[model samples]
Target: MPVEPSLRVAMTVEQCWQPAPGGSGTYIRELLRAYAELDDLSVTGISAWHRGSPPEDGPLPVPVRRVPLPRALLYRSWQQARLPRTGGADVVHASTWAVPGRRAPLVATVHDLAFRHDPQHFTPNGVAFFERGLAIVRDEAAAVVVPSSATAADCVAAGIEPERVHVVLHGVRAGAADPAGVATFRARHGLVRPYVLWAGTREPRKNLPRLVAGFSAAVRAGADLDLVLVGPDGWGDERDRLAGVSADRVRVLGRLPATDLSAAYAGAHVFCYPSVREGFGMPVSEAMAHGVPVVTSRGTSMEEVSDGAAVLVDPMDEDDIGRGIVEAIWPGAHPALAAASRARAAQLSWSRAAAQTVAVLREAAG
Candidate 1:
């Protein structure tokens, strides 16, 4: 009888919560869901805990183990030391910058080097954390996984070997139109008609101040368009800038569940993401999947993700962003653009990303 090959894989989830709904959290959830279905692999997950206990019972196709750390500092130290013991498996994958000191074919995912390149956009602590973590990633990780070729380039520019970097795109969850949900979300949020949607945390890099300026300009031009900003209110200065805009013309919806977010996307006339930097820009793909016309940034991952499906603008140019929004809202303006957006979205899927990730793990294990 042929013996079954021993394949054990360890996946790190440093900042993920099992039931949370943020982007990184969602990425971990989707990755685990896909990894669970693989036949020949035994997977283990390690994560950080703060508020509640980690879920105990997981009939999850693979075993999941959560290691609780007191704080981010402790977590980083644990990542550098305790990970090898925690991840007793043959291969280890760090989803974020939390690198293991004693590496056994380590694969690290570098979302973006934004904190390095755009220090003005981040807090001092954030910049320091990224610099330190990235140093560990460069020194320890055998291969680096980036969400886009743009990010891969960023990694190479940061002194990582280009050959060691791989680009694996993120996928949006498949969702159907929910009119009632849409109406409920709109009503609850006091959303009126003729709105453009911008979804993401209110970070300086999101360029919300610029977006507000552009939107206000469009509104002044008799566009009569409202702007909807969805995501968390983590940005102090950016939030204040957004608040300075006319409240009647701008609605900040904080964060919404996936279902409502889909409906919100469906209801929007166009999705505008003028982020100055991004790893993959999942929201752009999500907007495309929902058949919403999109206007995004020209350089960085936004352009690569949009693939001519959406209007590409100079993010720094308020005039360009405003004009893009106007063109998107004009009736029967860009049929080809809309069609291409959906086509581009159709090509991106979570399964493909998982398959690629698994292949990398398998290769590294060998």
Candidate 2:
């Protein structure tokens, strides 16, 4: 009998310390936890030297070792000099693009090429950073993993070989939301009426201006629902957009804790995410897992994430977005859609994602 080779992986965990961890942070945490549940590979996390621990450390599945260098210098070296070698592992996974040198087989995860989709949303430096990262992955990485087919297409368009691209759907872990917490969340936030919930980092690509306008239109149409926004403030604050919207009707609760976020999901009338583009739209999947009907953008990855269970709208058109929100809100909670949402979300399992990830690691290692 022939012996199979053991798989060992070293992955980057530097994003955990970023102020706004965003979708990639959630993806990393969930994937790592799921990876721990499996025995196929031994995983080690790598981070730049830092003083404080990450905000949420429970989901880090592997022991992390800190390199002596700081983040900014380390990233620059990875892109240009390819210094600070990351060896001693069969394969190295750049969970984000802050990858190590080509000392080991590499697999890079591409969340989205949002700058390519909406260049106006990013600063020149940010766009250049992404461009540089893509060039590195397209040239050196053995495999490029993306969360959705949409992102895979973007990677191919950026000149990566189609054979090197793999689409891995993310898994959702619904929080253990207490019922009293739901009531407290509603009371604490003054969510007196049925509210449409939107969550994620408040970045421009998320299309928040249009959402604010659309929610107001929905209110004018007598949808009778407040709009609750949950997320940390990213670039381009939408305060100017909110000038047209009544203050009481739209509650920007800022970022909430995991329990409160889950409670928000559990208590919402409808979850609305009208992002113009996304890699996978984790919020859509999370909302669906919580048994909520969703309203998301059409023709983006969120549309694919919804799988026809959500009310889809034109992300560019405030009228259309408003119409979608109203339709999702007015005629009562969408029991049929909720059923389909749960059914679809059920099929997206962390265990399955972990197994598929291992298979890709094996391929890279081989």
Candidate 3:
């Protein structure tokens, strides 16, 4: 077989994956892994870090080059001005909104327009920065990749042409099934019995307080269950509200490794995600892949990603969310629904996401 011609491409991000596990980090990791397997593309990853420090190395499949700068402000300025200074690529992909000044043609992945649509979720400066940066993406990027159709619609709503945005869904990495890992994760996180899981940062848009209320109501109704939250603490006064939930009934296991996280998903009675908005709710798909039922919000990408597999509820109504949870956890309740969810999850793969992304990059280069 003849090898496909390789396109030299540079992928840029704010941080490296070796030391973190946020959404952006996960996105970069999957993207790199997918690109590395492509015979038709040679990819190099660039990131912003400190100067004079040796670049951190990892087991990434693609070549990585870190450009050190003094601070985030300086790094942003450098990215806008100096990235074009050392260019030898057919295209540059901005994994997180910072584009090089005059480099090769660019493709940007705009995960969400949350900062614009829900300004209350972010700081004033952060909202302003995202608004301006997204505008740059709309005007300058050769093409913009969105994680969901909702985000693609947001791009169009923000004045970008509909033709310029592409929706490329993301997927979880495949791994070995580990029952021991599941048990260990439950024990370490104080997840005593069958419980509903909510995985995401405690942000306003996440609607954590509402979820707490819903879960609390379920427990009070004698649902012999717990609500486990897995994510780092986020900004906003809502953290206090979530903290107020009964500690015995609400377990907060902040950030776990992928292996343990997968185990947690597998061990759960059901996954409940009631966020009002999102680029895509990955946890819903992930939980379904583990053969666990899911209860998620109805609007935005939650319903789209769930794809009739999970229990859908109105996020604004605590009673509805509670009812959905009760139904999901009811023993042998929705075998057909659970089966359909697993089937849907089987259709999503990181390789497909990578292929779609590479296609966009090649098209942009042309």
Prediction-by-prediction clash tally: 0, 0, 0
lDDT of 3 at 171: 81
lDDT of each model, Cα atoms only? 0.77, 0.86, 0.78
lDDT of 2 by residue, 122-148 (tens): 889888888888888988999988989
Give per-residue CA lDDT, model 3, range 13-55, as digits (tens).
Answer: 5555324445776788778877778788888877555343222
> Model 2 reaches what TM-score against the true structure?
0.96
Query: Pick by lDDT: which candidate is best?
Result: 2
Q: Lowest summed lDDT over 10 consecutive residues: which window, candidate 3?
A: 50-59
- Provide the RMSD of all predictions against the true structure, rounded to 1 decimal: 3.0, 1.6, 2.7
lDDT of 1 by residue, 142-238 (tens): 7888889999988999999998898889877656767787788778778877689999877789999888888877777678878998887764588
Q: Candidate 3: which stretches are off by over 4 Å?
A: 1-4, 17-21, 50-59, 78-86, 243-245
Clashes of 1: 0
- Regions of candidate 2 where Cα sits further than 4 Å from its true position: 1-4
Candidate 3 lDDT for residue 115: 84
What's the TM-score of each model vs. the native? 0.91, 0.96, 0.91
* Better model by TM-score: candidate 1 vs candidate 3: 3
